[model samples]
Target: MTLGFVMLVHTAFDRAEQVARHWAAAGCPVVIHVDGKVTRKVFRGFRDRFAGDPLIRFSRRVRVEWGTWSLVAATQVATERLLQTFPDVRHVYLASGSCMPLRPIPELCAYLDANPDTDFIESVTTDEATWTIDGLEAERFTLRFPFSWRKRRKLFDRYTEVQRKLGVRRKIPEAVRPHLGSQWWCLTRTTLQAILTAPDRAEIDAYFSKVWIPDESYFQSLVRNHARRIESRSLTLSKFDVQGKPHIFYDDHLQLLERSDCFVARKIWPQANGLYDTFLAADRPSRRVAEPNPGKIDRVFSRANGRRAVGRPGLYNQGRFPRQGFENGITAARYNVFCGFDDLFDGFGAWLARRIGGRVHGRLFHPDGARFAGAERVFNGCLSDNPTLRDYRPEQFLTNLLWSTRSERQTFQYHPGDTPEVVDFIARDPNATICVITGAWAVPLHLSDLSFADMRAEAARLQRADAAMTATLQSAGTAARLHHWTLADFVAQPRDRMRGIMHEITGPGPRRVTDLPPMRDLTGFPAFLEQLRNDGMKPVVMGDFTATPGGRNGR
Candidate 1:
């Protein structure tokens, strides 16, 4: 499980030397590529610093330029050199001299060994919506810009604008769907080899040489097109501002850098002396190197179910069971039940679980339940002292929930109806049953909607999201039984009536009663209900709860 590194650097900074040392200490072979632009004296000084080290090798210098084909050429040179030198290297990581390891190298290597086939690269489709550069998708490949634009930035910008106005656009080569990504990545040896020795390598390189910022797109496009088991995520953490410049880390960002799941973080300024020591000191010890847990259920469930149950309990008790029911001695159950906020009817799921002899495992998304629970306790304490703070704002609660559960590194983005963790849990748990409770909130809906048209648009968006989620679940290869309980059907007398019913169902008193708004419209509800039915999920009004308690109800 040997790892290799291709460190691309221009200036022979002390930080680069430190980075090389770190990788070498981790038992990785380091291949350093000094930019051809650097002076002979500087290069000699760098080479002299690591004179007798067999693990370290220097690539043939390539004059690297920012946002040009030269950058890719330099990377290619380093990658090829590393492979030629260390043929047995399992994985090769492409990074810059400024990047520092966030986690212990052993842990990263172990994870890589576990996922040998997966390529850790962040890639997006060419038509990615979040492309920061204006006219990037079309202009990057279509515009023929001078390489000298790197030096004459202001003049080139005006020239580019004049060319655009003149309606001169170069057609991207046929059959090449341009994909873009971060320049840094960790790729399996097989994938890197494929990129270097690709059949269309010459043609692709020639085409990309004329493209703006070819370094960002060349490897990503080729690897995404070629790699068999690519995981679209980069292990390197980098922060980009509005202008698209990578943030230079200083002493203040140590806490954030420590919390990142990424193995490495980039653009550590050379001036930040002793920052490296601080990072090294805080690095966590590696976990036991072994194969990942075999069962898909075990992996996803263990991560999603939060840290509870230290040692294995009985097969039935291994799954999460409500504290109340387990304490009350309602233990005997044939099947496990996983319920979420939508499924809980004033804690009716727990009541139903006990009634039907099923163990109730709480929601999957609230993996940080304990954290939130502690925060809630503190909030309650504050309210007890100052009654004025007891505004009981639903929006406030929702904001807190999002903030509390948000991922430390990436933004917690999810489609409205897509709960992958929940879906995956049900798919893995053969004996598990899922109850999806659906209802519209009026207060939150009204607050969110600027007008009735906005409310309609919101309803349409939710409907689409729900449909997508339902499709995903139906496609999942699982025999687990699922039930959809629509609150609208149960209390259809009035719009406000359903809200009141939901309030009653999700209650234990003031604290249990959430400030969630009522449903904005009953229009999209029927479609979702019908889709559930079509997908073989039993759709029923809330009054039919008794008929479907536990695993008794089925399509």
Candidate 2:
């Protein structure tokens, strides 16, 4: 996912720097479009903050507005310039001064790489534009404005009355109905270019001319109008709290933020120096590099310094399992292990929520049984805004085999429906890994034989389980070497040692799978490693099986 970030900076210099520092660390090409109305002193000060890094782009200052079309104009123009200036860039994201990078840029980029042709512009159902939400609808009047905004100021209220009577419907074409939503997005290079060079540029431009707060709806509406396939959500993951901030990124919101798994978060306060520091501190353990701005497309393992990467690649069978769909083929070049579990433990589901709420090197998934996606469950601790309890289920035997890390960095996907895409993702990428069988169920795989009598039957089962998932990746042009392994064979082996053994059995293939890691290994990770290595049957340990994150979705 060769992504270039564009941040709309207004007055918050410190917040801009804070976000910049965080972004710079992720190794993405960053472009800052400061409000042109600001003084040179302001721009220069921000410039000095990133003096040496060449990847950081600074656009000619342009005045932006809160509810005006200027915001959209500013972002679109900046994005255009970036595309022209950096033709090689693959993805362009429109962000705000308050946004912060949630995942490492490389993982995010690799994800985008798997879905090349798709445009991630803001999109909603066609009727959403004229639809009502939270007791308000944009299309209710010939013109629509956020209800909160109307309530905030008397002047705006009067403006709404006048606008309503005037019926200023901005001459929307017969086919085009604008969806009023967040403008922030991560668009592919082609879409950004097409948007910039839209043939119906005049028509599109005219549509937003009279829309109140066109900035919020302009890009969102235009992209949908031109899109073949659109993701109807902003890439930035935010908490929807009663406080009604445009975004939810308070330091206190960390647990849910990590759980949500959206790559970037926005609208942070500049004065929260301690907050930024705390973020850096909390994320310190996951840091892939020691320096601030590393190179773009950071292959953490491939890096000369051999930095331990943080985010997990969602690859399995050479296919990747993102939130919406499955992608296959050598997803991430780096080594990554994603884990999952069976919902067997008492508090295991809740315990697992923490991991999904945090981060993962790959994906965080759970199983109803043989099915991959089923129900999801979060820890009871998380119910109170912030998750409290940790050491749940207290499986001494399990803990003894693993040392608890700072927090769970995982995501959960319940597989009641068939999604064979998981297998393809794991098989396509040789280095990518996944976990299965949570709680006590995953432990038996280590101790018993997991081979099946009827090979064709097993294949038939998997094929039927997720025909669409299987078809999607296979259609994408990648074949997988599918096989069955007995847990009895893999039991009592170090995970790394297990991989070597698997390599021998599977041969030098682009994609393959061996077995799931025992996440409930409370014994201690070192001990678990030692056990898995003892038999040379050990494969890569994706994660200890237990309740990780969002386990509550099991319903």
Candidate number of the best TM-score: 1
- Output the worst ten-in-a-row residue range by lDDT, candidate 2: 393-402
All candidates: TM-score: 0.51, 0.46
lDDT of each: 0.59, 0.49
User: How do the residues 1-555 of candidate 2 rate in per-residue lDDT, one tens digit apiece?
Assistant: 277888888867777776766666676667888897888897788888888886687877667656655666788777877786777788788888877766566656666787676677655544634322243345432564543353366765776788768866644665456565666777778777777787777776665555566665666666765666676666675433222334334666555445545666666656655546655543444434222222222232134122212213322322322342332223333222322233223343443343233432211222222211133233222211111121221121112111122243223332313223354444454443333322122332333355523322333343344334434334554333322222222233334434553464335666443333333333333343344446443323223323323221221
How many residue pairs clash in each candidate at the backbone level?
A: 13, 96
Model 1, span 1-555: residue lDDT tens: 368999998853688998898788778999999999899998999889998888899999988878788888999999999999998798899999889886778887888887888887767777764554333665787777674575988877887888899988776655477777888888888988887887877887788888888877887777876677987767787766434666678887676566555678888977776668865653556754433222322343344233343322211233544442232212111233322232223444344343333223333123232112213433221222122232232222322333333332111112233333344433333343444444322223433536655655555555555555555446656555554434433333322432343343333345332333232333344444454446554443223333322221111
Stretches of candidate 2 exceeding 4 Å from the true structure? 126-136, 139-141, 144-156, 166-170, 241-244, 271-275, 278-555
